[model samples]
Target: MGVKIGLTGGIGSGKSTVAGFWQEAGAALIDTDAIARQLSGPDGAAMAAIAAEFGSTMLTPDGALNRSAMRELAFSDATAKQRLEAILHPMIGARARCQAEAAQAAGMQWIVFDVPLLVESGHWRERVDRVLVLDCSEQTQMARVSARPGWTSSSAASVLAAQASRAQRRACADAVIYNDGLDLAALREHVLTLCAQWRRCK
Candidate 1:
């Protein structure tokens, strides 16, 4: 089997940017968030379960997940969040496993599982060979998120508060990539160097 690396970071920590670099370096990527989104899209695998659990209010006119509504509900109700996760996590995990197996069979040297909640999930550590965390300060995270359209400082702070703390994520990390204050080129260079080292280790 290929080396399975769990890639994670809190919101706006540049985890996606690092994952993109790994992809450029030939690592097969399996993003759980992307899979979850796909599974909640129109006529998606998890839609029926979601609609059943949360009712049609959680679905869009196109029969896809109403993400905004669900987000609101999830933040407002812990039981609702758990119910939604119960419906989606298993499906996402199964699909991710299948895709990882396929990549292994196809002779991929490395398979990066890009999961936003890797530390919080508590199961990914046992599934992957290594955990790579993109580290940044809370202020940096807030700034990055707030800069995005439709996001304010309060919204960014809310997200940051919901996720695992930096210390918590760092404790679980097998490797850490500090992304604060780095430009794209600098970050890419750092990732390239790390990829080289990982490849050599493999």
Candidate 2:
């Protein structure tokens, strides 16, 4: 694909905001999380594999994946998380690549892969030309996450613990957008500038 950019961030860092700007600037965007959820749904290719691996506990009454139960299992056991990733990540990556290729074939100048787990999945590092991180402090992340109804501070902390640390994510970035306190207009302007640079690279 032409100039594939990997966009990622820790929880609540506003990576979606930046991705929106890239979309506005004409870059094709593929959100891996959305694709992953699809792949983990009923009739998904990974369904059989997941069922075989985790057995009936991972299945819902309607015969689909029990996402809530699976989420808890994955978080509680490191091996469960690894097993889930093994079944889902490769499929997600392949789907993302296919979309990017389609965009390139259509003559798009850039493709942005919004992969939240890019830093955690070392295998994905080689798939993109650049990594754009939307940076925010852990405290900010916790606050934003906890403020959501039904989420406790500890629950938010568990989600944060599952991802790569802030320092690790920062180290992987080719460009970083500090998103701790900026307003939407400022964020939009920053993303516009970044997109301009990306287009120039083409």
lDDT of all the models against the reference? 0.91, 0.88
- Score residue 93 of candidate 1 by CA lDDT: 93
Positional deviation of residue 160's Cα in model 1 after best superposition, in angstroms? 1.5
Count clashes in each candidate, considering only residues at least 3 apart in sequence or on different chains.
Answer: 0, 0
Inter-residue clash pairs, candidate 1:
none
Cα lDDT tens digits, model 1, 62-87, are: 99999878767867887887788889
The residue ranges of model 1 lying beyond 4 angstroms of the native Cα positions read none
Q: What TM-score, computed on C-alpha atoms, does each candidate reach?
A: 0.95, 0.92
Cα lDDT tens digits, model 2, 64-118, are 7887687678777879988888889889988987888889999987889998999
**Which 10-residue window of candidate 2 scores lowest in summed lDDT?**
62-71
State the TM-score for model 2: 0.92
